[model samples]
Target: MTESGVAAGFLTLVVVMGIGRFLYTPLLPLMLTEYGLRTEQAGFLASLNYVGYLAGAFAAGPLCHRFREFRVLVAGLLISCLTTAATGLSTDFVWVTAARLLAGIASALAFVAVSGLVLLIVARDGRENLTGLYYGGVGGGIVLTGLAALPTARIWGAGGTWILFGAVGATLSGVVLLLLQRHDEPRHSAATPRATLPWHPRFARLVIAYGLEGFGYIITGTFMVAAANATVGPTGAHLAWVVAGCAALPSAFLWSTAARRWGRLKPLVVAFFLQGAGIILPAALNGAAALFAGALLFGATFMGIVTLALSEGASYAPTARARIVGLMTGIYGIGQIVGPALAGYFSARTGTYHIAIFIASATVAAAGGLLIPDAFAHEQARERR
Candidate 1:
């Protein structure tokens, strides 16, 4: 049951998050080429999705409290599959925007609900290490979608490709439903006393740093493929995204192991720095190799950052893991909301994503600096005194 639950949760995220939510990253370039969308418009559409994601995050808190987490997860999966398919049914910007927005909301609900359930299941079974495997589903989805897009784009074009992805997502969601049918909701014994971890300087720093991550990563996350297409060819862009997915697949596990050996903060600090470097590579060098290397670095660290940051935030308020995670996700969502549109707008005027990528890299580096040992050491000393 334990393994099944974890596997179900992992596959659910792969379908909902990987395909439903993020397939847009690779598809955005296609939309620009075959469809009639501009760079700025693509960014706007992406921002709308994030806005919907923020709404879904906010809704999940209350929805989970009122209903079963399993139901919410399933509903989210259904919604994501449907909306993803619906995106292909229209070329109208408004319709596509609305579909992406709803997909965003569904992806968020599925993500939050599944994450909580999986964590609960793992914690109960004492298989905490498996959590990395569960979270790694997002990367798996990215790799799947990126690789699939290469051939699909040639055969199907943008509209048909969206439909194809939707079909794939629906099929996977069905598999998840079957796996989770028996033990969807695991009951908790008793509630832990809510810890009142007041907002300290360190906590504030963590939140700010996480928000910076949202801003920094979304630029590349939203436009990396598009930028690669501009610099290299279509094939190079697709390969770059695939390389990113490949790098990302094991990132959570690698970072988790590193955290155990070296400590969470240090590993996270390094990840941020590496990610910053990754974010800038494509822009700095106009070559396929640089773009692929950059995507690999970006893929390797982005999800790792999410896992580490959320875990660290939960540690600060162990009794209120859901609340802490929600707050952090909301903050992160804000950064996402702003990033793509801003990048798109600047890129439209400047005719390149270099400036936006540079800014994003700087933001990521600053976020990493905040996680350095000295930054928190001073706070710890102050707390002791």
Candidate 2:
């Protein structure tokens, strides 16, 4: 495949994962009455999906070294489609959960493959710019589903929505696999026999921060659409997602431009603030405007934060970009796995998502502030040297 083809593959991969993954939240109300689920139970089932994703992230490097990335990518998508479609077929909690877990694993494998493929197609300078465009597909998928699937839920119900995605995912899996560009071995290939990196102090902090973003962001991912619906009623909630998806569509360009002018930390700090403000938007004013603004703020900055922070993290050890990013991705996945559980606990205790959402809001706010201290410290060290 050409560079353009590869970029399209990455976009398709994100869209497929988006379809199989977060497509559940807006349709949760139907799942609630259709399946007899409490709030905590519903949240727990969502975590089950992330659990599989966590496992897949950790396994990506070693598995690729053992086998081949293209094969892994194709199989993962096939499994994800089957599992996601089957998820709607069973109204039972256990069966629904089992399907979700499998779907998560499949999504993770394809994601890891596509991320690695970026370097194969684009050069180092271009990687930072491409990161947002690649990941932006997640938001794009949300927009597509929000506009289309939410309406489908009212008509054919959740089963039909899931069934449609299964076909789409299966088709894309084959298409992307065939379209994958042939490239030389990745320079930073973790699968290479000689590849290795010893974790250091600065890199450790970057990893921790990235995981924190995961902890904070997953709350929005799990509940943003639900919160919007609850705040202003269902008719407008899907439109809030439209705001998010559209805002997210351009985030890659916005963040990348900022990073280019001001440097990585500056844009990342701004992103954290955007997310924190957005997360708490509902509590301040429970209206359609507030919710829509929140979704736009959250969606616009969330993935860009991941792109900038992780790209900076990888630079600290450029020789191992794929592995280091994969490791951080796994750690981030762990935070996501825990995020839903924490949200579930708070929802159970307070009988609302407010406590959980606020907890997330505070976390990103602090993370943004933490970057200030880090910048000062780095400057001081440079002066002393």
Candidate 3:
């Protein structure tokens, strides 16, 4: 049942986060062409989704506490699937925008709820290492999106492709429900103290660094397919996304394993630097090779970073894991909301993404640099102890 619960968490992420939330990246170029949407408009649309995500993330902790994580997860999954499917029902920019907004909320609810549940389950079983596997679903769903996007768009148009993704999400959600059936909810006694966010310097650094990550990585994530198509054509664009997804698929597990050896901070710092380099590659070089390589690096790091950061955040307040995750996720969502919009504005006006891409790369590198102090502080503290 524990393994089953873990699997359920994985599948839920694939459906809500992968298919419902991220499917937009693969379909963005298609949406642009099909709907006559400009780059700024597209960016605004993406930002709207993140806005909803931010709201949902802020609400997740309280909702979970009031209703239980299991109930929240179920509601989130169903709504996410419905919203994903609804995205196909219209080409009107406003209608699609509304769908994306609702989908974002649903995805965040599911994300927070399932993450807390899975972490609780694994921690209880002394298998917290499997947290990485649960996060692998994000990459798995991305793979499905990359593999399915072009073919389905060709056969069914962008609108129809969205409907198909919705159907797929719904089917996967069903499996998640079955696996999580009658799942035990962690109950707190009335006397148990409420979990509060710590003001530790390390925790603050972690949250700020994650916010920077949200600001930086999202530009590449949102525009990679479009950028690839502009430089290398549709086939190359699809291939690049697929390569990214494949790289991401094993990254969380691999990075967590590395952390178990070298510790989370070093691996995280290294990943931030690597991801910074990746963000600059495709924007700097003009070739399918550069795009593919960038995709590989980006995919390999983002989910791993999430796994590491969340695990570390949990360590700060084990009793308030869900609250911390929600807070971080909400901050991250704020960065996401701003990133694409600004990137789009610069790209559309300059007719190149170079400026925005360079800025994003620098921001991510700064996040890495910020963590160095925290690492040193931790080492000194540990030695003293």
Candidate 4:
């Protein structure tokens, strides 16, 4: 892959997936404090975003085929920026809800578009390993969110912080547009055969495990900072978030390298189990130290899982890049939609996030368990074949 293509892909992820989608996590506490937003309402709003993301993932493949990745990616980024900014325009729950929903759709579009493009490019050059670097943008964006929110929330409140992130996202989007100006976006060729998903048992297993991962990880991703803030104050909470981001930034690259050395399936199984442990740590213990340790594990494993799963999926259907990606992402989105809503309902009633956290951890452990057969038995079977 060319340097510019890599840079553009990285920055696109930073703008959309990082700032547009995940900035909500660090800002959740602020919204709760500023607008008297209830936990259930927050969960609903988050689920709405994932709902839109599900819609967007389903749409991304068709849109890319119809409009090309460049146009779709650019449009998604712009819409993401606008929707993020719109959140600051009103304190009304309805308004913020709409904003978050729209942001989710835009984020999914941009995320899938760029991922397809980058994966296609790297596949041509045997640089599939660089996917780690490409996905690291999300962590980079999360770190920025954590850092910026501290002063911005203190100075102008949650509304101002939202507006500021919107502006920053827009600026970065413009940079991505420029950086990618020379890179050729892939065009679907009429001569190429239409791509279809293979009806393989391994792919089925992967989809189920990935869906479970989506259901399991999002609870911690959405609420870890808030849970920490409640336990250790705002400063410590943000610090924990930053720590997660720091671990996240290198995780994709490191995990990718490990997969290259150790083979993909075993490493993937390890990541899933490690992530399960990470998700439960803070809930099992208390204090800043526990939170930070959990944050490191959470950050380190989530993107690594993404890098491995998506790459593995791509290998399964090389001819249908967008379709396979959209399918996996669409399933993942469903899990995301369900996780927070249930977590919020239970937490709000019981007055602690402990129940939700424990369930999430167990769900992730189950996901890891689902992959063990593939990691061992199936791998040996495939090698024999």
| Candidate-wise lDDT, in order | 0.83, 0.74, 0.89, 0.87
Residue 127 displacement (Å), model 3:
0.2
In candidate 3, stretches whose alpha carbon ends up further than 4 angstroms from where it belongs are: 188-193, 378-385
RMSD of 2: 2.8
The true-versus-predicted C-alpha distance at residue 119 of model 2, in Å, is 2.8
Cα lDDT of model 1 by residue, 127-214, tens digit: 7677777778889999999988768878988788889888898898888888777564644333633336549777788888999999
Candidate 2, residue 357: the lDDT equals 89
* Clash count per candidate: 0, 1, 0, 0
TM-score of candidate 1 versus the correct structure, residues matched by position: 0.93
What is the Å distance of residue 156 in model 3 from its true position? 0.8
- Alpha-carbon RMSD of each model: 2.9, 2.8, 1.7, 1.6
Clash pairs detected, candidate 4? none
- Arranged by TM-score, best first: 3, 4, 1, 2
Off by over 4 Å in 1: 182-198, 373-385
Compose the digit string of candidate 4's lDDT tens values, residues 210-262.
89999999999898888887889988988898888889998999999988876
By TM-score, is 1 or 2 better? Answer: 1
After aligning candidate 2 to the native by TM-score, how far in Å is the CA of 129 from where it should be?
A: 2.8
TM-score of each: 0.93, 0.91, 0.97, 0.96
- State the local distance difference test value for candidate 3: 0.89
